[model samples]
Target: MTVAGWETRKNVPLVGHQVLLQYRKGTSGAFVTPKKVRTDRDGWATATVKATADGAYRYDFAGTSLTRATTGSADFVDVK
Candidate 1:
């Protein structure tokens, strides 16, 4: 899966930082593990995930830098 998100500060892109992705399966309260994706110059980060069994997966992002810190989440990713 290609995961993309924007890192910004005060309405401007925050570049050259690492965004962490944590994921879990349906109804699971704990995330398996975390992965890191680096943002581009425009503050966009992408992560390519490997294939998995068809099920509902949830994910979230956390990014931290010298100047900023942020977090976000999304609905389950349904793979049929």
Candidate 2:
């Protein structure tokens, strides 16, 4: 599975920042930390993982000196 998202604050793109990719199995399941990636010039980070189970995917950017934008777990996919 490929996950991608933008790290932005006030509509401004944050480049070269660290981003984390996470996944959660079936509903009510605990989330698992799978990978970390860096944002590109466009503040976009992407990660590809082989899906082993039906779950959700989301990316998060930890706050940095560059920006204070942080994201919580969001549902991007629901595999049935």
> In lDDT terms, which candidate is top?
2
Question: Candidate 1 at residue 2, lDDT?
Answer: 26
TM-score per prediction, in order, is: 0.59, 0.68
Please report how far candidate 2 places residue 8 from its true position, in Å: 16
Stretches of model 1 off by over 4 angstroms after superposition: 1-10, 54-68
Clash tally, candidates in order? 0, 1
Q: How far out, in Å, is residue 45 in model 2? A: 0.7
Clashing residue pairs in candidate 2 are 1-49
Please report the TM-score between candidate 1 and the true structure.
Answer: 0.59
lDDT of each: 0.55, 0.70
The TM-score obtained by model 2 is 0.68
Per-residue lDDT of 1-80 in model 1, one digit per residue for the tens? 12233453335556766676666666566665456776777767777676364333333445343343445654466666
Lowest-scoring 10 consecutive residues by lDDT in candidate 1?
1-10
